[model samples]
Target: MKNFRREGNSNPVPAPSGGVVAGDGVLVGSLFGIAAIDAAEGESVEIASVGVFEMKKTSAQAWTVGAKVYWDGTNKVATTTASGNSLIGVAVGAAANPSATGLVRLNGVSI
Candidate 1:
């Protein structure tokens, strides 16, 4: 049976989805190279939404691989610097298989 659309019959608005897709994460790696951003704030960012934290290398530091991080961006506790990219992000994991039933950001325009 065809669903009914009452009202003035305007085009249906599309749902939000297909945000930044999380890649097969490293156990304890840096998120700095997670995704190169041309700019911050206005850019569309996505995380596990619920899982381990995704950490990114902030300074000239090298962290061990296979470690879980919450992609809290750089300088999370502090503000971003003009020279480096210290933007905060989210952490992701496999409790929800972001691939099988992966996570995605809704309302791309909203973000």
Candidate 2:
């Protein structure tokens, strides 16, 4: 394990233009990630770019396993649309017209 570099669960990234609170989704550099905790101006906060999170769903849309999920930055919700959206990850499960939230597997990736 001498050459092993620790891959931490989160990364310290500067707060976005509007600042970020705990559990808020953010677009840092080329990475679409989420704030692990609350942070203020002049401070670095931890952002998690991986793992599953219960994200808000834009509209009452049905989602199926392996469906491509996108992060709607404006609405702060997860959707299946690709155009003008940040690709987050895939839907881990199915949701029939999900109203509030749904499970999304975040891979910190984009198309």
Candidate 3:
């Protein structure tokens, strides 16, 4: 374990412009995570890099169980559209179109 480091389930990163609220999905550089707490812009915030989270999704899009999901940073929602979006995780449960939220399992790795 000479090269061991802390487990990366969560990580501390500077909040992006406009800050972040608790439970907000965040993309810092290439890392994607959910904010563990509210933090001001440029302040350090602990982001959960792995685990299942109920998050906002594109209300017009329907999601099926096990479908890959991407993070739409600008709109701040989970989406099935791949182009221009960052891969965040997969849908763990079916989400009906027009629903406000969806269940997602974090992949713990950047796209």
Candidate 4:
């Protein structure tokens, strides 16, 4: 227990350029998490690294339960496409096409 630290389900990380709003999904290095509150760029922001969250998804793409979800940082949305996206978690529920949000269980690790 000598090297123990606080539970990592949430941690403080610098906000990316352009800042982030509360509830926004952010990628710090290879870690993906949801912003716990609004923070300016370069400021330390608390991010929830693991949890079931209702996240923004590609409105045009439908999602099935258990499908791998990736974070499209550029678009600030959750996506099923793996190319150029960071693996964040899995879909916990089916999502219909044109839906703006989807339920996701954050895996906390980028891979």
Provide the RMSD of all predictions against the true structure, rounded to 1 decimal.
13.9, 1.9, 0.8, 0.8
Q: Which is better, 2 or 4, measured by lDDT? A: 4
Better of 1 and 3 by lDDT: 3
The total of clashing pairs for model 2 equals 0
Clashes in model 4: which pairs?
none
TM-score of 1: 0.19
User: What's model 1's overall lDDT?
Assistant: 0.25
Writing each residue's lDDT as its tens digit, candidate 1 over 1-111 gives 368654321111211132222332211122222222222333443322222233323333223322222322223321113344222232232222122221221111111
Model 4 residue 74 distance off true place after TM-score fit, in angstroms: 1.0
lDDT of 4 by residue, 8-71 (tens): 9998999999999999998999888999999999999999989999999999999999999999
TM-score of candidate 4 against the unseen true structure: 0.97
Candidate 4: which stretches are off by over 4 Å? none
Best by TM-score: 4
By lDDT, the candidates rank as 4, 3, 2, 1
Candidate 3 lands at a TM-score of: 0.96
Runs off by more than 4 Å, candidate 1: 1-56, 73-111
Best by lDDT: 4
